[model samples]
Target: MAGTPTIFLHAELLPNIRQLTLHVSLPNSASEIDIRESTITLSESCRAVTVFTLHQDVELVETLKLPVKVTDASRRNLSFAGHRVDIGGTESKAQTAEYSFRLQVDPNDAGLTFTNKGFQEDDYVPWTASDMSTCAALHCKFCKQMIVDVASKPDTSSWQWKDLPSGNWAEMMDFWHCHKPDVHPDDKEGQKDIEAQNASVKGYGASNRVVATPRTGLVDVASFLVAESDCQNIKVLEQRPTSTSAKPASHDGKNARNIGCSGCSAIIGTEDSVAEGLRLYKNNIVVKHTGATEHVYETHSIDIITSSRFLDLIDHEGVRRFVIHAGQSNGILLWAFNPDLRYSSSSADHSIVSRRAMKVLYQNATDVERILEPENGVPTPLSLEELFLPENIYDELVLSLRRSNLLMPISARIFREWNVALLDRIEKRP
Candidate 1:
């Protein structure tokens, strides 16, 4: 019994009841004090959750948002007005908790609503793949500007993200869960290397668990991924026992968790210190970020086009957009393939295409985040033509190459020599 409390309620009302309300009885007698805790304690992390979506047997265009009705016990209602999930350029006009989600169509007068209740309150989503992780781009630790603002350098101090083990995606996921750098349940595998490989597969770029954004995505899912250049962080949460665990458990029925002496609930934030491992946030999820040990800018072996393969598998509907290092391999990779580029083939010998990434581009992307692609944003591809074909292409190439961790310029002749040597490699490749 910790000083703080968490109670959950689920119920169904008959057609006759116009409204349903929930009331929770706490040990505290002061009303103002208790109310403040709800605001500070339960962050606005709770959004709408749904078991189903619009179009029962139709092609899916976008992931529909379904609002959730949350309240305490005693069946009292909450006064959270202005409720709706924004969809396809339109916001639901309803202020009710459980509203029917409908794609814009005439037959959908009934809109969207969930009556059967698919998941209970204390379901305990304990993995990076948990449903809540993809709530919105704001949830991703690396992508969201507020967490790791574009201007703020990458969490260089965060553990150097070791590339996940080489294995199938499923195996990588399993490995991530078992060998999470921090809290993790003791699986039957007993901390084996194979388990770590599996977790890395599923856990890569996942929101609940943080990793590097530039390399986020199931890259090796394609056979084209002959080798990996993956690098990012991992965390495993420690588990507590019914009565045998040494760490204090959470008072909220969810999971008996540890509590601070002053009584702030445990939350993982972006302060970059203890924030690296854990913190005490109410609703928001923080993916523990350890800086990468490897320099991602290192000139990678051109053995396999792993970057191009990643762009191919992006579920553009479920995603918002990508934040990549300017002129890095990812941009070059996307230009080489991405079907949406209006190009016929990746290897078609044509003009060099690339997205010129500015330091400000990433630094400015604090609020823009998406799991698939930015709903209102477009994928920015800094092309090579912008920096590599004109009057002073060499000068621009020098900077770009330097950024790519290629040859550094020592003198005019030295730069020309390095330039000739590099172009020679590309020209002879075919």
Candidate 2:
């Protein structure tokens, strides 16, 4: 019989890896390989681990200690096959143990409801069960790293994916609530602001409170939906606190002196630091919740904005130098990260999009647009269409052709590439 092979996080660095743990397994094969991190490349045929030779490998009788390694520079989050890992530093206050999130399975498709809400965080709304569409919002972290898949499904080493557990389906609910600003008769101040923004929108008059995407930022889907109707909330990635530990250390002692912000990694109690972490916040929308605490952003408020405030925060008061966007089937993925985050959140309707797809689009778009551009990294959007899918994703003509499976990889890959190319072109246009 094949050896009971497994992997472990031997070392995080090529030279040194720390924090080792073993969690649950995947659903399909019971391959006890724990899928930590949300970031990874999606290959329909990629397997979760190279050691997962069979589905039964996941159902190991003893706690399997496979030597799993994190291959990307992005943060490594915690997640399993169909389930997300449940871990947090905000709540735990652990120093270096938060390596990833951990959890079991409970896929009732039971939509997330607001309980412990924060700014721009929301759950199921009894009010718009029919009018608005909802998603599971699963992912503890937002790193869009990936592992290999499908063609060599048994050995998933090549596929890349988002590995950070910044936001899972459930946490995503919180994220959605924070950014997707809610507006109703209840939120008077918020309503007033949205009303004013709504008025300034030219041509697209009906668009609601979506403040014009900052000169550098693109309008998020949640914001766009609000522009269309009473958007439940909008999720944006702005800067926030990372920890309440050691006061930020100073590299120059002048500006970095005693710098402590919300998401600081080593923030000392009352002491300040220059580092920070991400948090969810809201723009418009009247959020009213029944339960929770009283942080600037309530844990259980009716208003929610699925946003990443950490993006607004920079390293020890660092400034956001990049404001890029990626188009997705359902919406646009805004990439806004500061130096502190070390890892970044790849925005998407689903958890991630394939790197190969991004690469293919990068290669092809150069010909169609007659422009010479960098192809190594994902294309960043500078315009609205560039940020989100322009044509109805399902209706794109290019995708329709690949649906028959002629293009290598798969249809999913083709569509993802097209989205990347389309956004690149639209963003580059004046």
Candidate 3:
């Protein structure tokens, strides 16, 4: 409805029949186009014309003919979403008059073949956890220890302060949620002071919906990772006490200690006596090279690592060079390569020479140049070829690219073209 309504036609060839389906998008007001009044005619023995009048004045007509003979024709008016028709090939009963269209086709006597162009080869398909596991291992960036086996227990969870309450009990719940000192008073005098302060507040003694309920597992909780029990492997690098008067309460109603990786001294998460478990922050931990290890904590669901996680996997050396290209739907295409190890070599290595040269091209090319430049100044774009890469590297790159929302829609052909362009540039530089 936003733009000119475009109709798409699909044709399939069977042994003795050629099936043609027409998908039409009509304006919201133009419902139920009388197919009986519409006209379909064959011209030049290969072209077909469909004409219908809507709103008594607006005439919708299409003219195209294929090499086929007319045997029978049928039309049906149905209500459906515009997107369903865009996807094509799906059959659904009419429910509403939001979207209306018609279909017309005839039997083939000229023996012309029919093919469906609705589906593309390069359409995006999501990667499974197993696909990702095959490319890289989940390990701690600092110690390089197997922190998580994503293939087995792919799920992660998190916890956060619950929403503040309202009414007389609002102040009390706020104090607890914020870990206020009065909520964890040390003496009867402090408790009495809090009670006396709220005494003037109406409905202070009345019970309301705001109440603390104990929950297990990560359902409806913040993102968290079940850390290994060996606290020795991880150190409490820094501690921010939420309670100024006293230590914060843990699961056991005792003091809590924020913890971190002992190896890298990076703030990883918190240790609460009340929770009696090491809760790792989802953002703090790194996932690197894969290895086989058993999970330290129980899991309910598998958390599929997504494109945003690619940043965490980058190492100290970082990427050799990177570029961003404007993509469809206002997205961005990110191209990055790992730092070249061949640069450290003394002699002139062909692989290293090619890699360095490719890096120069990437660093120097403008966004448009990167995507449109010809290989060796040839007319064809550099991406219109096959790319050669190590299996592991290719898989890793594909996974990251597919997961990233920044990239444009990836069809198999587009992915191959992009991959080839990048790899070919690198491999052919020397």
Best by TM-score: 3
Clashes of each: 77, 150, 28
TM per candidate: 0.17, 0.17, 0.22
Model 1, span 65-171: residue lDDT tens? 11222322212123222222222222321211221111111122121122221112111112222322221211222232222221123454321112223334545
By how many angstroms RMSD does model 2 differ from the true structure? 24.0
TM-score of 2: 0.17
On a 0 to 100 scale, what is the lDDT of residue 14 in model 1? 17
- Predicted structure with the largest lDDT when compared to the true one: 3
The residue-by-residue lDDT of candidate 2 on 13-129, one tens digit each, is: 011122222232222222232334222231222112221223333432212212222223212333333333322334322211212222121122111111112212322211132
Candidate 3 backbone overlaps, count = 28
lDDT of each: 0.23, 0.23, 0.32
- Residue 343, candidate 1: C-alpha displacement in angstroms: 53
TM-score of 1: 0.17
lDDT of 3 by residue, 266-311 (tens): 5455664433446544334443323534443211111112211222
